[model samples]
Target chain A: MSAEVFEPYQVFVRRDALDAMEHVGTVMAASPEMAVLVARQNFLRRDAAVGLWVVADADMHSANTDPQFFAEELDKSYRRVDGYSDNARRWKRFKQQALQLQDIVRDLESKEG
Target chain B: MAQDDKAARGPSVAEGAALVDLLLQMADDDLVLGHRHSEWLGVAPDIEEDVAFSSIAQDEVGHAALYYELASQLGAGDADRLAFDRPVGERRSAAFVELENGDWARTAMRHFLYDAFEEVRLDACTRSGWQPLQRAATKVRREEFYHRLHSRTQLHHLAKAGGEAFARLEHALADLWPYVASLFDLGPHAAELRATGVLPADAAALRSAWEAVVVPELSELGFGVPACGGTDATSAAHRGAHHPALAELLTTMRAVLDVDAAAASW
Candidate 1:
């Protein structure tokens, strides 16, 4: 898939799911200086991995594991647009809008049929 | 409801068996046809077309297997035997699925025709009251969306390119047309299945729906629509013989299955 030097990992990072902050994924490194080059030779032997994650999965903790943490499930909701009740009204409204859109599509299909 | 009829109600064990029986026919149609299509892997006229076609072939075969698994659950037969071991005539696939890939045009024509039928058929099936069949039909309908798009994409490009590609497609459609009609062939379940709501529409209605949707699209794209009128049914050259390519396809499809009939993992 990659014969022409297109920076395979950069291509990979775009196609793959990643976040600077979410769940930790595969992390690889040497020193800050040689890390990129070291990762390239080791992981890119075959065009396998596109990008590298520096953190380990175990190192990551969810609120449930954080023990006294999950103390504010309600608090995180504000951080998420979805978790906000005010947005819930919008979500419900949008959901109905999507259904109406779906019916319109079905109507078009029936006419086409 | 009568004694000695061996009939069924909704999705009970008996109904599941009956459902599976109907479903196997659908599944095998795609599976065997997909295997035949896959033979074209890497040999298509160009690389991009090859990737696109292979993706389609794989989807068809995979969907076929999914259908067989549903039948298997109803205790009809395992997917392997349902696919490979049956005698040819025992198969219920319409003649269209069995026809050769022909040239690219032929393949496109067959593809165009089959996708039209399948989309409508799946849509009707999704409306069925039986839950499992309904859910399965819904899934197949979603996959068919992509297949339909792929077929038309090639059809548009081939008709536009208009050279060897056009010729191959046209020839494929003409030779494939007669058997393609066999896709609407009605068998024993015409009344009972329709009565029980096993299928939302009969084969005849499906054929009409197909012609309406498909002919217009092809005509728009500059391909000829085979005559749908004026022929008496009995006189209609309805007999379908196995094209030579089909035999080769069966051999290849069963090659792995034939080794150690006891090997069940496939």
Candidate 2:
């Protein structure tokens, strides 16, 4: 069969249940069923995946086509994951305070006994 | 004797040889067909299919190695020697897997039929009286689950496409059916294997179980099931008598070893 009859699909794989489906690559297949089967070997040969999705290229839309779509109109740092980078330090401080409180409570209990 | 006691003690000397024979059959079929499937590596219909065939081929060889390891433990020989050094007459692979991969249609047809038969065979092995074979069968069956899925999906898509695809698959089924029955031939140890519960079913029972699965599905796909019988190449008596192609295939397989007899472990 000629390659023209096949359609392009964007392949995505989830390595585990908690993992997000990451786009691995594109594959050409005659149907969705074939696409999934093909995408499996193409993307998951070395790694066992818990999930896979193949979306038709025609069904996909992206803002990358227009460079202006990604141009920042204002600071949108809050919309990205890096905005919460200080959460690790904050959680560590909170945990230390909580542990101190627990020690004080234990001291009070021992004195009462 | 109870099945547990039998498994605990393992096979008698005769039964050990029979077990080795059975393992060789399974291993040789996988190794041979895996080589055939590997032939499509760069020449498959498309890049995706190339990847699929390559992965499936690797899985088949891996399964073959698993069986060979079991056979080696039973004192058949070194696993590598058992796989690569055996004489053609000693090989127990059926005519179905030994034949050439004529076309994509024939390859797909044989793959579908063979996987279906393998599933039934493995299902029986899962209950084997020999603990090692049972455990190995369980692991192999888990991998085969995806193989059946891939084969059935391909078969369904091609048959449903109708016209050229459907006709090609139909023709392939007709061409392969006579030899496909050879897959169920359990060789000379069928009676003892069954009696010992090493194999829970004999050839006829396994064949019926296999048909019970594939017949309805293939019929629904609009392909006619050809009459089942044995050809000279595919008789139960000639199960170990391999196709001539096997020697050619083995030559190619042994190319690396031929060059360096003491090649480092693969």
Candidate 3:
């Protein structure tokens, strides 16, 4: 039979229920059923995996391979939690002021007593 | 008797010998077939299948090692010696496993037949009165789930493909069918093993169960099911006699081990 008889299927594995499925590898099989079997045999031999997914290579669509597809023209740090570093600093200052106010209240209470 | 009673008392002299025989048969089958499957490492039709077969082969060999360890506890010698040093005539593996890994069709068909039988055999073993054997059988059966899936998927694919693929599978079935019965041959200790509850059933009963499962599936796929008889004479040849193919296979399998008499490890 010609090599074309087999189609490539991408394999994905999830280690646990809470984990996202990650790409493992590709396996060549004649049909989707065979693909899943082959994917399990090839990829799940050693590791513990709670989930597996096999997608036909033909069925997958991807963005252009050009670096421009992933390039960020402007800083997008604000989109990430690390960009809110000032919030962490402000929270620490707020905690310190609250502690000082508590101390002041305690001192007034002691003087009154 | 309960499995707990058998475990407490251990085996009698007769039962111990019978257990050794059973373990040898199980180990030999896996060792020979594992070697055969490992031969497909780089030569399989596709890279994915190559990896799959390799993993299956490793599991089979690992199973053989487990059986051999159990046999050693029963006075069957060390695992390595039992695996590599035994003469061909002494091996208990059925002939089906010793047959060449012909074309992909034959390989797939043989795998389906052998794995199906093995699945049944191991399932039965899970209930063995011998606790160690039962535990080992249970552990190995987990890995066998994938093997059964692989062989079944490939066999169905070949059967349904039609044209050359189907024809090739048919031809392979005709060639392999006669040897299928020999896989169930449990050797001279069969009765003793069964009576002692070391084996749940005799070869005939296991073979019938195997056929019950295998025949209808093949028929549904439009393939002719080979008629079952008593033990296959051809496979019987390998039960106590040496087939040339087995000798050749053993030579290759032992080549590295034979190279050094004093080597500490493989």
Candidate 4:
């Protein structure tokens, strides 16, 4: 008898409501329905997952693996939060000056009374 | 009055024995079927299915352990001894579970049939007045949900696949239907167990419920539902009678523990 061939399915899992689905593993199944079931058994046995997804491996497309795909030729710190550290420092100083002016006004009013 | 009120004082000798009988039937079915499923560990259709099947086998065996613990508390022997030491004639698992795993189609069909019955059975147990039985039933039913899902999905796929897949599944169902009927035989203690609130439904009621849920689904998938009949007493598994396959299964199941007289643990 000839053996039946099964296709590979990539599995994705979400741990909780706030979690994003992450690629966990792959399973072999005759159909997508069977793939979901098998994927649950393989991935959710130990950990509790809020959701699962199974897609045919062949259907998934990936970009070229060349380092240039994600490479940053120059420093990109200017686009990051840490790059705005000067603004945060200036804001803190402004808040302190505002508080000092309020104190000074209160002291002058007390002296006038 | 609530059934729990009737059983609040605990079971009498006969009632306790009846409970033990029911527990053994459940435990033995899970144990044997779990062992059979484990045989497909590395040889299933593929690696992922192998892992999935193995996980299911582990769940079944773990469930058997829980039932065995409950039985031990009810005055049956230790869980290990009761599971491995019993002779073939003393086991209460249905022939459907003890049958050799013939092929993926046969195995899938058997699982589909058995899981459907077990889901109904465990649902009934959840309503049981007995606290431990009810709790165990509730806990095990969660895991059983996945098992039912797995089997039902595969069964539907196979039945609808057409050509050879449909034929194989149809043949498997035909071969297993009669034996599956024997799973509902509650044996001599059925009336007592029902009366004592250990089981919310009698064997016949459970069988009818099973048929109601399963027959339409099978029909929808283009498979014929076998005609229903009363329990076959001659081949009843709960009565300690089993298929020929069970003997060999038990031998292999107990091999490790049986090899040494002094090995205290498994």
Candidate 5:
């Protein structure tokens, strides 16, 4: 009898084409291929998946313990359109101004006529 | 019920009987083998493998249900009754599937060999003249792709590991080789099924295709290839005669039903 030590892998699966791959769980296997096979059974049995992935635990670069690594170190909100949370209200204000501008333009045209 | 089933398939009673026999062979093989596979559920060598065996076992039982559903449509009786109530003499599974799981190596070896053969059978089935059989075969073959992947991956890894793992797998190959040919037996209706296009015209070619897939892989793995060909009696026996282990397996499988047949709901 041979006792073998297995490598652990993080399992990820994509539920469908439109879905992003989510980390489902982990499996212990001797190889990447075997890990994917084990992951299929462990993670994808009940639901359908368009794709599966297994990254060796050893290969993963974890910043999991360093909360500061993921922390916002600088104000970079300009890069995100959604960062302007009041943009909806701003757009509403703009729409009202545009309507008033349209009214003024019509009055100017009436005078010009 | 029989009339609707017959109308759906459009086979005469004589033809229906032959078809039922064929369906039983496929169902019994999967059911028995799946039961054996389930034995490894919580006790496999590792955690991942336990889940793997559980999935494989579920797939096998599901495939068996698929075939049994076809058989029932052809008037073979309730699927549960056909699976659990049949006497050993009436079962059509080969002695190969009926054997007990000896070890992880043996189980993997058997899984590899059996899935290879099933690939050929399901391929032929995808072209079956019976539309339901063809459709069912297509679906089963899709799920089975993963089974083949898992089995081949395990066999290749174990064979490459060398030392005791390699030796155990090699021993398993030798021990299981003798019963391999019986898997190709298509029962008494082989000729009739062939004539009606239920089975492919070159029925014997199925075994050839299986060997074409299996032999080179085993050879590359440095395992000795056992001599080819089973005796005529060996091929003929699997249809009606079964290994004694099947009875024991069925006893365990049907324990609840045997105790209280009327109360059994599921």
Candidate 6:
């Protein structure tokens, strides 16, 4: 069995750490854990590092930046609790009225039986 | 890191030219030296060492960039033109930076010796109280920390690994010792810099401080500390008669830049 010889700046890090710092750093690491230290020196020199991660510079994939990917088809307000909120307690009042109707129906069914 | 009012003192137009000359000299030294070290990018003996040495080289270049920028504000020239377009004879970096890379062991020894002088020069600059220059030295110090670390590690490694074979390294050290000592050669600005409160220690005291660091380290490396034979020994490089290798370096570095000097864009 054989592994490729490591390059000069190449380093190994643990796997989990890769997911942690994906957007935050440029760590050309062989392992995820080692990437954290390298990333600290490269980007966080003047800042504090809460945690770090690395991925192989080669293995990681990125889309060929298409402008279409960024275009919005419709308002994304449905995802926002504030934007989509029903005012006048509409949804809550509806739920209460529905429950009351269901209780009346059950009472009527019991009388019929 | 803010500039002091004193640092803002302007010389007469003639004096401005003179100071600019001196500043350019100091800046160019770091630039040329950085280029030499950068050539070792792929070939450093160990993998970790390659990264470490490359970082030091980059730091040296960054220091040069800072100096050049300072000179530009003073109307010497932009940093790029000053760094690239000068002739060998007209150029003013020290001879220590001009020497070619020999072998890894010798390179480390030279670097070990170089760091001692750099740290002292920087310390002298730090206390200069010329706020802008002081800030520059402080920023450079942050990077020097790594340079010294890598140099010390490499020195220790070679000293132990090579044993008797380390003589080549010693010879390189001995040759560079006097030249390296010259880095602390405070120029005519000694009095001016002091009067401006730009330098706390005179050049001599700075050299002593440099020796204090270098002596113990050299001893550990199995190399004896070299002494300056005379005043001439300490001050020769400022005259700019550099190592022979400097000519070839200048030629190669300027080859592309010299072609389009008057062109509006690169």
**Chain A TM-score values, per prediction:** 0.27, 0.61, 0.68, 0.66, 0.61, 0.36
lDDT of 1 by residue, B63-145 (tens): 88888877776777667788788766566666567766667677777787788888877877887756567778898788787
DockQ for all models, in order? 0.01, 0.63, 0.58, 0.48, 0.52, 0.06
> Per-residue lDDT of B119-229 in model 6, one digit per residue for the tens?
877877777554667788888887787677657765775576565547777777766766764465556566665665656777778767877887887787677666553
Q: What is the alpha-carbon lDDT of model 2 when measured against the actual structure?
A: 0.88
Evaluated at residue B105, the lDDT of candidate 3 is: 94
- Weakest lDDT window of 10 consecutive positions for candidate 2 chain B: B228-237
Clashing pairs in 6: A13-A31, A13-A32, A13-A33, A13-A34, A14-A32, A14-A33, A17-A53, B128-B197, B128-B198, B128-B199
DockQ of 6: 0.06
User: Candidate 3 at residue B180, lDDT?
Assistant: 70
True contacts kept of 2: 0.92
CA deviation > 4 Å runs, candidate 6 = A1-101, A105-113, B1-4, B8-18, B228-237, B262-266
- Count clashing residue pairs in model 5: 0
Superior by TM-score: candidate 3 or candidate 5: 3
lDDT of 2 by residue, B1-266 (tens): 35565656767999998899899889988999999999999999888899998999999999999999989988888999988888788888988898889999999999999999999999999999888899899999999988999999999988888999898888898878877766877888889989988988988888889989999999899877775544423343357667788889998988888888887367
Candidate 5: where is the Cα deviation over 4 Å? A1-4, A64-113, B1-9, B201-203, B230-237
Residue-level error in angstroms, candidate 2, position B115: 0.2
**Candidate 4, B107-155: lDDT as tens digits:** 9988998999999999999999788899899999998988988888878
- In order of DockQ, best first, we have 2, 3, 5, 4, 6, 1
Residue pair clashes in candidate 5: none
lDDT of 2 by residue, A5-87 (tens): 79999999888899898988999999998899989888888887799999999898866768786678888877889958899
Where does model 5 sit among the CAPRI classes? medium
Off by over 4 Å in 1: A1-113, B1-18, B229-245
- Give lDDT for model 5: 0.87
Candidate 3 positional error at B55, Å: 0.6
- The per-prediction tally of clashing pairs is 3, 0, 0, 0, 0, 10
RMSD (Å) per prediction: 22.0, 7.1, 3.8, 4.8, 4.5, 9.5
Worst 10 residues of 4 chain A by lDDT: A1-10
